[model samples]
Target: MSKPIRKAVFPVAGLGTRFLPATKAVPKEMLTVVDRPVIQYIVDEASAAGIEHFIFVTGRNKAVIEDHFDIAYELEATLKSRNKTAELELLSRYQPPAGQTSFTRQQLPLGLGHAVWCARDIVGNEPFAVLLPDMIMKAETGCLAQMMQVYAETGGNVIAVEECDPALAHQYGIVGVGESKGADAFAITSMVEKPPKGTAPSNRFISGRYILQPEIFDHLSRHEKGAGGEIQLTDAMIRLMADQPFWGTRFNGETYDCGSKIGFLAANVAFGLDRPELNADFRKEIARLLG
Candidate 1:
């Protein structure tokens, strides 16, 4: 049997220039989708998917992200004094067990591939999952968990994929479909980073969740820059793919790219409406705002 996937790497070093003023001092990952910071949702998903070790590849001004996972003693005390049992319990539930979390700084804006490479020492010689916090997946089964199911069946690289409009496929990393592995999973014949409009191999675009073998570090160590003149993770994956089999699964859910303004606002509404206490009122508020 393949080694159990017990660790997950989160690449959170991106400078959120797109979000601007709001992200000036706050790490974009700390921005909230609802009541929880964006990174919390990603970590919750990883934990639900059986990831025991939480590794964060962070950057400057990102200490808040780390602290969010740590205990807030003064606040906890305040909540306790106020007898806010539910609020205090919520905080405790979110804190990962001691030593289960580790943070390493990326230091430079090298790109996603380099960020993953920064965690090589921690990942060692085992397969691991990489989750981009910006891509929040809403599903009955966490996207990474869904991909883990595929990994268990096919012991190689696995990526979560979603179909995009063919005309817009050129704007994302597109994949080619091969033979079926079973269910929504399939062999990935090709991966192209933003191919020209009509030349995309398929409409399926990688949705920022990956299960990769440690060998990928060797390929990324070369620091070869590809699209956008940065160390693109897709470039390293393509090199790794030459030797290892790759599989893709279309997760049963919606993905919100919180890095974009529109995607962020949409996620808030989507997640807010998902809460039992807020659903009815939130839906009505949305209708009112629309009018």
Candidate 2:
């Protein structure tokens, strides 16, 4: 039997240069999609999938993320004094229990692989999940939960994948499928990061969610730089696949890449329309703007 995945790593050490002034001090993971920070959505998903520990691989200027997850005593006191019970309850809903979260510094702008490697000590010898905070996934069952189901049966490396236009294959790590594992899962023969146009094995791109065995640390420790001269996680994963089973599951969700400015604005609109309190008015405003 596969060891249950109890820990998850959130790699949020990037400088978020795309957002510039807004991210000058604030970590990109702290940016709100609608009302909740992007990282909270990911953490909530992990928690729903039975993740017991949240490990954050951070960098300089990321103290705010630590503080975001930490309890705000003054703010809680003010809310309590005002009898803002509903607001307090809402805040408490997102706060993970004390000692369930851990933070460690990546200490460099290496790459996604290195950032994940930063959490190796905490992950130890068990299977762990990796969630990229910039991808805001919307689904009825939650992407990570769907992945957990696949993990339960497959018991190996499981990656969340979604179909993208063939023309945009260069923008993502495309999976080369070997055989069908089930209706929504496949045996991944290989993965190529940002393959050149027309050279992609398939249009099914690897999204932000991953359930990896702890042995991957060995490959990442080499710090091998592939595409863009960075320690791409795809490279480490490719090496890991040489001796282990790697499977991909098509996620049951719509993902918005909030790492980009346009995608961030679109996520706001998408999430805004989903909120009951703001839907009608936000829909009207959007219709007016488009007209």
Candidate 3:
């Protein structure tokens, strides 16, 4: 029987060099999508998928990220004193229960694999999910939840994948499709990180969500560097694939790569439209702006 996926690792140590001045003081993950930080959306997604323990691999200047999930006594008191029940309730809903969240620092900017490896102690000997904060998956059923469904049946490693433009496939971690495992999943024959344009196995690219076994820690511990000379998670995954099975599920959702300006702006627009209170006015404002 497969063990329940109760923990999730969030890698949020990256320096947002691309966003420049805006990201100079703010950690990229703290950048808001609509009103909530990008990390909040990812955490909400994991919580919806039944994840109980939230492990964050963060770095310097990321203390705000930690505090965001912690209790703000003064702020809560102020809200309560003012009879701001709705605002207080919203804050409470966003705060994780005490002891449910943990934070560890990644002293260096190693890479994605290394950031994940930093959480080895917290994850211990269990299967856990890894979510990239930069990718905001907008779906009725969260992306990680969809991958969890696939993991429950397949019981190895599961990756959330989505079809990208063939011309842009080389820009992502492409996977080769194999036999169908179900309506939404397929056996992954191969995985190549940023393959040359036309040489990509398929148009399907990994969509920043993962369900991995504890054994992956053993591979990542080796600290082998690939691609850009940093410990690349793709390299460790490729090595792990030699023995274990890998499955990919094309989730019913759209992904916004908030690490990029375009994707960040798009997510704000999309999420704004998703809000019941703002949908009508938001659309009219967007239409006016476009006009």
Candidate 3 local lDDT, 1-291, one digit each (tens) = 999999999999999999999888999999998899999999999999999999999998999999999999999999999999999999989989989999999999889999999999999999999999999999999999999888888999999999988999989999999999878889999999999868999999998999999999999999988888899998899889999999999979889999999999999999999999999999999899999
Better of 1 and 3 by lDDT: 3
Off by over 4 Å in 2: none
Q: On residues 1-291, what C-alpha lDDT tens digit does candidate 1 reach at each position?
A: 888899999999988999999999999999999999999999999999999999999999999988998999999999999999999999999999999999999999989999999999999999999999999999899999999889889989999999998989989999999999887799999999999879999999999999999999999999999988899999998988899999999989998999999999999989998999999998889899989
What lDDT tens digits, residue by residue, belong to model 2 across residues 140-170?
A: 8889899999998899899999999999999
TM-score of 1: 0.98
lDDT of 2 at 205: 95
lDDT of 1: 0.94
By summed lDDT, which 10 consecutive residues of candidate 1 come out lowest? 181-190
> Which residue segments of model 1 deviate by more than 4 Å?
none
Task: Score residue 207 of candidate 1 by CA lDDT.
Answer: 94
* Most accurate candidate by lDDT: 3
Considering lDDT, where higher is better, how would the candidates rank from best to worst? 3, 1, 2
All candidates: TM-score: 0.98, 0.98, 0.98
Each model's backbone clash number: 0, 0, 0
